[model samples]
Target: METFDLSRLTDFDFEAVCKDLFEEELGVRLELFAAGADGGVDLRHLSSAGESLVVQCKHWHRSGRAKLIEHVENTEAAKVAKLKPQRYILATSASLTKGAKDKLFEILQPYVKTPSDIYGKEEIDALLRKRDHIVRRHLRLWLTSASVLNSLLAKNVVTRSQALAEEFDGTLRTYAVNPSYDRALELLESRHVCVIAGIPGIGKTTLSQVLSAHYMAMGYELVEISEDSDEANHLWNDELNQVYYYDDFLGQTTFDEKLAKNEDSRLLSLMKRVSRSPNKRFILTTREYILAQARQRYERLDRHSFDVHTCVIDLSDYTYQARASILYNHVYNSPLPQTVKQSFAEKRVYRPIIQHRNFNPRIIAVTLAESGLLSGHHESLSDDIVANLEDPYRIWDHIVRNQLGETDVKLLKLILTFMSDIRLDDLQELWMELGEPLRELRKALGVLDGTMLRSMHQYGAVHVGFHNPSVRDFLVNYVQSDIGEVTSLISMVRRFEQLETLWLIFPAPGGGPMAETYKRRRDQLEQVASMVFHAEPVNLRNSRHGKNYVRRAWLCLEMGLDLESEVIRELALEAASDADTILNASESTDLHAFFQTLARHKTSRGEEIMFDCISWAVEWIMGDLSDWNLIEEAEDFLRSIEHYDPGIEVSEALARLDSVRDDYAESAFEDWAQTHRDPVFSGSEMKEVIDHYKAIGSTDPFDMSEYDNVLQRLDEYDAGHETPFAAPRKDSAAGLAWNEVREVQSMMQTLRESSD
Candidate 1:
């Protein structure tokens, strides 16, 4: 028999489990009430005989059987006497002995009816084993089950799997099962691919993490794709059950360099492959706006209908109960003291947080996680939570301003210079380059680890990044508010990527506080343009990609700086002269940016230079038609040239592209077949497993028994179940108390009325 740790569920989650369990056990529908000030009734049912049945659930497994009995006799007995229901059923997660049940039975003689009406942990587990539907209904129950967690921890010894297991452990504790989970699961099951799209701090990544954990539990190996779809393509194994997760597959804040390398086509191709394979699953997450931007920018993405496999997580996905549960779970799992937890429960301090218009999962998590940094007073905590929810952009303001020291703040500002995660050594070098002490880097990293940043060991090197996208979001707003900080960042730039980041945050001056700030800092803007013009172009991969130089030239033009300045004129001339080099080394988007800059700047002999570059590009494409990327790039280049200058003749180039498309398709298939004929573990996989065990101070051989046990449990659970991906229960207020439900309903109604 399998036993779950009922302690994992909050009072409300436990009550929900009991409601579902008894509804099937007793063959009657039980109406669940919200928690709080309940009059000895958590659930009630009216029998055909006109009898009232009352059931109360106490999730006091951690409080011991003695405490449970004492509370029942001293507190609940009087309430039961007052109610005088025809039948009273007691459910507690505590494992009660026969003597304890009898004692409770004697305490409330007439109302208890019989001792069998009392259910304890043992009885609940037995019922759950019999009723698989109830087990699936309450996600927390099965997700946090001892069997599942142990299986996750013991089965996979690889470094990535172990680290992910630990993360899944923490996330499962605070994760709320919303409708989006079910929808995403359905899409992944039916289509084998799910793209989770939502706004920042909307739990898109969290939902994907939970779904990844689900597949992992079902004996699927987790393959985390960090940079692009090439990682997925290289790691794809037809013989192994694998689930791939790529978070923020698109550019985080803007469509910059991520989709520039023909990633749109590669991503779609991998999706097609995953969809065709029975043992493979793919999950990708991106902000909805960024995804829309990618679709608009990339013709391939725009042409493909992602809506069929997309799961959009929005506010509507989180009902009142879901929001409340999110709050409850975060608070429950936080490392705060008991006093702070009680303060949230007292006087309904959670009401404002639950009902706030800007309620967001990330904001809620951040607020509760950093609650220790706030004043200990209950009112302060309540007010701070409400304030953070009201304006999420300021969620990290308090931490950056009040909690973090100077070195810590400086580290975050420096990190903001990059588009994504930065190598620790690279960041350290950058830190030292900016005249900061090397010793302080470690100290600042420690101080900012959980609150503001996170560091992970990948590919044998430590990589540090913001804890979430919101941290970067907060820091961008932080620096944009002050011009001095902006200038300081520009002065510290050692590569073209950092300058690109600055341009993204502080775009061409238009209308807004940022634009006004740029206006006030015109001299600093000119200084940046000059710096980029002279600096050597470097991509994120630390290579001198030609697109970086092209990007720099275009960025200077967009800044509205002096085109006649010596530095600007020199940069334009260099770009125009080296147009062939730029075309050969850059992507279609980069080529487009380069040509547009040339057209806008109109360098000396610009038209002749442009025509020469276009001819060179056409001849280069005619030289090779072996790869799909080459074909697509050629087509995009021709189309862009046509769009840029309608008078340019490109019928020959167009014919060359159209004729060899089928030849490229046949060659691409042969290439894939040759490359993937024999699938084997890569060297990185072997090294990762060895290094992971070495780091954990373990070299023991793999434990096959544990793996077999996990498989057995999975088989047993799925024996008679319809599907693991069942639809969630519709009633959001299933386990909430009556008054709390009324409060949520009232708040929701007020919101509707206000909107009307």
Candidate 2:
């Protein structure tokens, strides 16, 4: 008897296997964590759907489900028994014995409300999808097993190459979110280990995305080095078939162990391959920190595989072209909003809050966006970039030189935390909460709120969200060495204010709270509310070029554009068709307003709002959906996504299974056959047998061929007859529908009982 060993598997291969398989069959995805199996469950799926099934893969050499019954008690012990999935599916690569099955069934029988034969699958499915889905996806990702003992040794690691190639090609579609040009030539020609570093929110990722698209356009066979998967390892050993991407390598660290392997590490291996291959091109994107790790080498084929290279493009100051792009990319390209359009033409001297720093299109875009000064925002050559930009190096050096005290660090945290747009009044309470010295708080606060932080701060107070999206990431990483005692203090403040929203404010879902606040704050508000009198959109619907701005306005609001609730929501709905599916609702400032706009669009556009409806359904599945109507629409939208996946037929079957035969199922099945492919019958011979059974009304059919065979079943149609299982009554809607032969069993059972 050998023991099972799953620890031999890597996270990536196991998770991918589970994601594609378990979710397909069970609608549950599992996530596997590296450490700490709670109780006996090594994998988990967090779900709201009340039904959960604790699955135990019985790896027993020879087993009984009666022995498996021990795991059932585990689910109950964990207090998840009630929400337990309908079937305690004892899935195994092993077989079960009849005696063991009987014992397990006996144990579960006491808890069973009705015979398993009579149960409606609806309750089970709802719980699986609605409540247990997240947990399932998570668990599958974590615990899906591969048979290592029988695993084949690779003659050539072809699968990794293929998967990587697929992943690389797949990123081309993502270019819709971020665009690039001639990326292959750029990477291939770069002379040194080119560094492309930008401040946070500076669109470095965009540059990488664009570069991928460029290589694809130039006939380069693209290979995506999956962050850390066995498949990726195999990819390195097999082929340097094409250009490879080390894109976002630093973004996730969990895969670092796999990446560290020498030959197994795809990036290092690809580097060697390309250095040797003729005219080879390789593209890499990393934050400067990761970039620092390499020898900053140039010219390869070091059995080192480097190719024709040029100097890395160090794009400085939002070049006029970049500023123009900021203006153009974010503004209305369609039916433009007039009021929003006019403001961009106003020639105000563009002074960067973080002046004189190297600027990217995003910083300029975000600043103009956050300030709600889109149209009036202007650029000037005379504007001093060097003077205005806070030299982060200099500021940190100064603080370090002064032996920056506790107050200085605490004040720095508060300032950075609230750099977006909170009031001085808000800061006062935060100040006391942290218990920092007042003078120190005030002094650092001034610098942070001042030009010292540059474009970092909007108008002193934080933008007011879960955290400062832009700088919070910066502070967490960089402040570890400098700005002493900062992150620990910031973490404490964050505990006091779990979310960055106002403590007193609690807006209800729809409209009441916001409308009330509108009246109360209409007069006294200082930041954005003050600007209500003259709201100018970054995008306008009027001019030829500005027509796009109106559409752009909606996108801006979606991507953290600060705007009045009504304006942003309306804009979002107006151009919702073009919005990215990945656009999150949490990013929206006023969710209700966005929903209201959705409601209005639903009312006005009806079926034309397909894309928005699809977006809503995806959001719905993620548990972010609120409206009941949204759920209804999601059912319809599922039909739409159905068109995209081959599995739609199965989903439709599942949907049909949801109903007890009613006019809906009849109509649904009609529509399904009319609109999509139909389900498969058992077999030609079984089908013929079923037809014969149908021909002789109230006649007995032969016992089903096999235990798993449906035709072999002999459940009684009515209770008067005794059988192994009860026959299904016509679902409340669909009348009893067992074949006529099943009815004969009922009559026979009745006759036998009467004679007794």
Candidate 3:
């Protein structure tokens, strides 16, 4: 007889299983009460309409049919008679005969109206089959075959890409608690297509692999789609009750390619078939920009590929907690020395990793991997962390520098100058244009190896690009050891008149940290801009002008150089649609001056254009408006634009920020400050504070300098009392003495400060 083998579950496990089965299968949420003090009711089910249910789980698996009935009658019936629940359930592990179930109901009389309430072993088996996922999750020894997943994929001629499954088994097994996992699981249950999308190295592929493992554990068959056109088609033959896994279904290899691939239409057709079949799930992963570009370029593929029901698991949805979990998972599981691991538990050690905007899973993984090779000193660890956060590309640069040759380096620089993935045939032409012979070109590619350069077939043409976007960034700014020769070669293929060429090389738009490597070369960027501006004086109004205009504006904005009238005025036009360019060009200190420039342009250009410009600028700059200093800056900038536009959104977002300025417990901030040895509020906490304030109504809080000083002093006090993980400060005795004097002076200062 096929059975659930009820002996495998303990009394507590039986109660918990009953809770899951009732909640998931019956759609009734049953609350499992305390084990010993459940008042004869192990599970309580309350219904809003009226009748509530009280359930008892008797794990009498060892008792046969006659013994189960006797056990229930002697103990359970007496307990239930006292309580008198509206709907009573006797859920037991032991199999009961039909006559025994009828007799139990009769013993209960009116309390148990139906014999169905007295569940037996046969009924438990049916419920187990319906909610088997719950059972599979609880019992490790439950028979869910990994081979069942393997057998789903049909044999075909197209070769499979490297799975990286074995390489990343540890990461997947210990996957952090991200909210997206539940969302992904829920979507996969109902929707046919669930696309996991994110920026490069942000764990999109890893997430897809983890989800595949999850489905495999759930007894769903797994089928991997091949990159080859015919092979991808050959593998999808109405495989029911399966999870079809496709990684990088939309290629990230080339930006210039119009179509994702001719093969994608067929893949979409397969997805359509999956959608129609209720039992199948189709999950894929792709970079965000690649998917965006594909939607823009291919109408048929997009139209058939997605619906209102399609689920997209995007990395942008990751909150600070989720990001912290990613960092924590990697650091906690790493084979670092015990002392280093202990230090990581300190707030100061992990806080920076959580706070960095460039904080990425790949960067964290690589940095920690390299940490294992180094001596576990605090100085070395701190330096490594700071270096990776500041210049993540340096990690890739280290790998490339040790692996590649001189010819390979030259070829990479040449590719970096192009700024886009080049077709392999077109690359050969560019090499010939550089006066390099065909044989030398082949030699250069051979020396470059697959680690640094990746070759992929998109459509029918072969495309070559850097293996990672960070690698491309590294090559562009710092890999200029042979710059003079490379510059000469670039000048031959393209004229200096196209300043957009230089503009395209800078990865980030607003002179962000990514562009810091090139900021020192501001003079070079300026010279190119001047040459282009002089050569094509009348070309300012054309579409080509936007790229060069933004680039010149960035140099002026970052370097504090005087902006030309034409560039500033035209940039305002762009800012009406692209406010990010203006915000990115200026750092936090320069925001007032940057906004003043925009206000001047808004005054010249009429209210409609300027209002849109101010709207976008406000949206961009107000990201940190919760800070007291930034609020003051925002006030000044808003006054500059007040004559031309009202700036309602900007004012509302700011007004909302001012309401809860002192909302947090200063003592907690002081505690964290003392541990971190830094007075500044962390970026993560600042974001939370901003979000909290923004969600509430505005308030007219006291405009007191002492309020700000209170925050600063708390930091100072914390710093004065340094503990472990904090770099020690010398003058603790003096600080303690000053602290007493400051407390007395604070009352008088607060009155004066408030009056001022």
What lDDT would each prediction earn against the true structure? Answer: 0.69, 0.34, 0.53
Which is better, 1 or 3, measured by lDDT? 1
Off by over 4 Å in 3: 1-163, 168-171, 226-230, 239-241, 258-261, 301-321, 332-335, 372-379, 397-469, 476-756
Taking the candidates one at a time, how many backbone clashes does each contain? 6, 76, 0
State how far residue 127 of model 2 sits from its true place (Å).
56
In model 1, the worst 10-residue window by lDDT is: 747-756
TM-score of 2: 0.27
Task: Kindly list the per-residue Cα lDDT of model 1 for residues 118-168, writing each as its tens digit.
Answer: 998899999999976567656667767886677565544222536666777
Candidates in descending lDDT order? 1, 3, 2
Model 1 spans with C-alpha error above 4 angstroms: 34-36, 45-54, 69-88, 96-117, 146-163, 177-179, 214-220, 335-351, 374-376, 509-565, 583-586, 619-624, 642-651, 664-756
Clashing pairs in 3: none
lDDT tens digits, residue span 691-740, model 3: 43445643223223334544555445434432222111223111122121
Q: Could you report the Cα RMSD, in angstroms, for every candidate shown?
A: 11.1, 32.1, 24.7
lDDT of 2 by residue, 1-756 (tens): 112222222222222223333444567765433211233332345577755444332232233334445754444334334435454433332234554455545555433333331111222223334433322232211112122111111223322333333332322211121112333333454431222443454555455544543333333344444333233334442223334554544331111111221222234434433443433345565554333333231111122332233223334434443343334333322123433433333233233322234644434433433322222323321132222134323323433235445564555455443313334455555676566556766676554442223322222333221122344444433444432333243243332121121211222223433334333432222222222212332111111121222223323233222223544344344445544432433222122223323433334453355445444434444343222222223343344354433234436533642332233223322332333232232122233334433665422323323323343221211121211221112231011111101121121121111100
- Per-residue lDDT, model 1, residue 229, is 86
* Range of the 10 consecutive residues with the lowest summed lDDT in candidate 3: 747-756
